[model samples]
Target chain A: MKIKTFLAFVGPSVLAMVGLIAVPLIGVVYLSFHSSYVKTEIVEVKSSVPLFGGLTKTTVEKVPQPVLDENGEPVKVWEYVGGRNFDTVADPGGLVAAVSKDRSTTEDGQPTSFRQRMDGLYRDVTDIDFWGALEFTLLYAFITTPCILVLGFLLAVLVNSVVQWIRGPLIFATLLPFIITPVVGSLSIYWLFLDNALVASLLEQFGAGKIYFLKDAISIRTLIVLYGVWHVTPFAFVILYAGLQTVPQDALQAAMVDGATYWQRIRYIIIPHLRALFSFIILIHLMDAYRIFEPVLVFGSNLFANSLQYLTYYILNFEDNYYKAAASAILTVIGICILLLPVLRRTYREQKGVA
Target chain B: MAMTRDEKFWEGMRWAGFGATFLFMAFPIFWMILTSFKVARDAYSTKVFFSPTLNNFISIFQDPYNFGPLLFNSVVVSFSTVAVAIPAATCAAYAFSRYQFKGKNALMVSVLSSQFVPPVVVVLPFFILFKNLHLLDTRLALVILNLSFVLPFAVWMIKGFIDALPPDIESAAVVDGCNRFQVLRHITLPLIMPGVVTSAVFGFIQSWNEFLFALILTNQKAVTLTVGLMGLHTDKGILWEHMAAASMLIMIPIFAISFTIREYFISGLTMGAVK
Candidate 1:
């Protein structure tokens, strides 16, 4: 009786998720293999004479090519030849024939050629552009994660010491950077740092030439890292600030009473207590950073500085290569899974009470 | 008795450190707002504290393809996503919190893990799915996609909120001959109202600020503010003044929401995952 009730309750949600989420997810997997094709249909009219020389007509038929392939061979094929409208047939002893070609079949009516089965899974995993984008994505994530963590920790520590009256406004001010959309954020950075702008102007004042933020590979990469750090650090700060608030005051007092230095108290009392929040924030940021798209797209709006995420966007939007884009996206998912494996495993075990 | 000079010196250093940190954190936003009011020429000048002008604001609004529709799109998609997501999540969350059932733990974990799935991973597949369904380029398509991200977080948050509520209140209603629907409407919903609001606000902000999905799923009619901002960086040059105006527009709603529900936003960030 309990089992039936549970099934009834869970059934709809499971079905909805499967139908809306899982089926499309599966379709993405399917589309990664099959090439997207466009089909055009044309009809031709023909005229012929009946046996009694009375007027009769027949519709000529032609199929351009196979719609679907079987074992990598065209299951249906057609031969089409061009001619002037009814001119050849009007001439004496003129004839028209529609022919078909099956490349897999030999002249002796034997299937001599071997065709390979469609390996969608293998192709989805092995696309070249996908791998390049994967590498760039990892590098971006790795570089930015630590920067945000350290900067956030430092900011949180500083905020923790502010007077009660000022803390509220100060906290909100610090959070403003993160509240804006990343698209705007990256554009702002681009405007500031692009050639002859504020950053370039400042550099030029110091005897430096105008800096092209997105021109060179190294600078563009650097810009992306900086942008990622700038955009994401506020999120880390918010989480760390909350975590800092929860640190036991008594423990800090005890450490101070033991004549430990400020840094020492932070290292032992504050850091240890904030481990779960730190891990949670880090995991979230890492996953988010790995999929860095908008900033890269906004800042590196051009051909160069295309990070893996941006590359995926370029492929999907510019190239219109859905199969390759799907491959890249799949790789990105795998990269995130690998990065998050430790935290996910820990959560799984804790939930299951296995450790 | 002697006063220690070292202690005073360290206190002074702490104050200096805080001032520097505050300045660092606050300057970008200060600059953003400052640039929004400057004329195009004055914006490029390095001199500080110039007379401010409203030219940027005027230009942003007077222009044909200004921030108007993009802002409207953001508002519509965000609120629509929140409206759909919150109710669906509330139902699922209530079941998870109140009922003890098989696959309960698994379902929760799956929902949580969905948050970890990179948006890039789903974009391509979702693009194909939407295209096949003829949902591409529609506002409804964006709302549906946003829900996938927003719904999980909403569910997790509402579940946490519901878990914090006392079950005895509902039990009393049950004892008074209330059916499940009546008890939920009269008792549970009212009790967890704050949680619902918090979840809705969070979902709205997330969907509003979400750029990746919006950049991919939307074009032309449904072009959101975020994607529209990207247009500022064309081949001609980066339009700092116009971009700043747009940035200011996007930040206003999010800042308002964050400030209003400051405590709930903090709690919602940590949610059940941390504590």
Candidate 2:
């Protein structure tokens, strides 16, 4: 009887969890292996080049003709077999006929392996643009995390210590960045940083050159980091500020009575008390910062010196290579899991102690 | 006894630090709002102070992509999510708070860990799933997704608040022939109203500001303000004055809702952290 009740209660939560979360993640992993291609209706074999600002067309006699059915319609001309390039076209019969026969061997006449043949049929996943994107994403996350944390902590402390009348407005104001959609926020930042815009103009007036905020590589990266900090700091501030409120006043007073300076009080009384909160915020921020997309997309990915997150978007949207994007996402997820395991374990222990 | 020079100096330093921190935190937002009122040429120019105009505001309203629908979508998603999530979460929170069930700790831990799952990772799958289910490009899709995200948070946060409430009140009600349902509806619900409101506000704001999931899941029919704002950039090359206007319009309601229930948001954060 007890077993029945236990199963009944656990059943829905488990079902919802699997249905909502697990299935989709598994589906993404599955789709990575499959290849999608654009099929052309007509198989026209022609080559063209321009000569002195004029058009030229050439029809090559060596081009392999398409197989036809009884209806005189062309059949499948290309099969994406999987690998480095999608140049190896196979005929319907799977025979090493005209196209393969001629282009199959080098001048030395060494026979190519079936693996090599197949490898030539598809674009290599590793050689795709996803790797550069992955690198940029990691760097972006690493740089933005500490800036948001320290700044947010300082802001949280400031808000918490303010007078009652001003505190409400101040807290709300600090949260404004967070409340605005990242798309809008990124656009706002882009405008503010434009070469002849408010920020650049002010810089130029102070003997600074026309600061191309989003044009060059280093400047773009700096702007992205700044944009990330601007967008996410409010979240960290809100979480830490709440943590501050829960800190036992008695402990703070005792520390003060012990002749501890403000810094000493913060170091001893505050930081230790907020350790769990800090970890929690950091973990959340890490997960968020790693998956950054909208901002990069809005800012224009081409402008960045190195854009990790934008690269992911480009791989997914532009290249349409789900395999590489999926692989990259999986790698990101693994990195996050590895970093978070220790934090999760600690949080688990703390929860257990409290319970 | 008069204060020493050293004490005065320390006090002055603290004040200076406080002032600097406040300015650092508040300036960007103030500037954003200030820029929203600036004309296109002025907004683009390097000048800090200029005559503010209502042209951006006038154009935003007159523009085909009216902010109204997006704002409406945000409200619908936020409120609907809270309405659905709170009741569902209340039930779950009650079961966890009242019952000494097996795997309770594990269940609680799972709920807490769910918060860490990046929305990006789930978005693609959810997009495909929603497409299959015919829920893609609908407000219902966002509401349901928001519920899933908000429900766990609601459950965990409300559980903390409920657990803090003395069990003696419920025990007495039970002794007086009140069934579990009656006790919860009449007794438990009233006592935890503030906590419920807090959870609702958090859920609402979270749903309101949610971008990645909304961006991926919905297109024209159910696009929220966040996604719509993204469209502005993608469609129009980054028009600073227009974007600033759109941003201010979107931020107004979020500011109002968050500040109105400011205490609850603070308490919700602490409850989430401490737990």
Candidate 2 achieves a global lDDT of 0.71
Q: What is the TM-score of chain B alone in each candidate?
A: 0.93, 0.93
Q: Evaluated with lDDT, which candidate comes out highest?
A: 1
**Per-residue lDDT tens digits of candidate 2, residues A1-355?**
1345434534554556566566656765565444554433445666766666585767744444556768786663333334322111111222323224443564589877767655553223212344345455677788888888898888888777768798777777677777665676776676677768777888888998777776666677788788888888888888888788888999989988988998998998899988888888777777777667776776665544334445544555566555555544555566678767887888778777777
Off by over 4 Å in 2: A1-14, A33-128, A156-166, A245-259, A302-312, A321-324, B1-9, B46-51, B132-135, B234-236
lDDT of 1 by residue, B1-275 (tens): 65599978977887887777666556666677778888788877765788888777667666655777777888899989888778777776777778876677787888788776666656677787788898887788888788777888888889889888888878888888886657767998998898889899889988988888888888788888888877766575767877788788888788889999876776776676455
The C-alpha lDDT values of all candidates are 0.72, 0.71
For candidate 2, write residues B65-174 as lDDT tens digits: 67777778888988898887787677767767777756678778888777665565566566656778999889988886776678788888898988988888898888
Report the Cα RMSD per candidate: 12.3, 9.7
Measured as a fraction from 0 to 1, the native contacts recovered by model 1 come to 0.44
TM-score of chain B of 2: 0.93
Q: Clashes in each model (backbone N, CA, C under 3 Å)?
A: 1, 3
**Model 1 pairs in collision:** A133-A308
lDDT of 1 at A159: 79
Please state how well chain A of candidate 2 matches the true chain A, as a TM-score: 0.71
Which stretches in model 1 have alpha-carbon errors above 4 Å?
Answer: A1-20, A36-128, A206-210, A301-304, A352-355, B1-3, B233-235
Per-residue lDDT of candidate 1, residues A282-320 (tens digit): 778887887677766666543444455676677788888
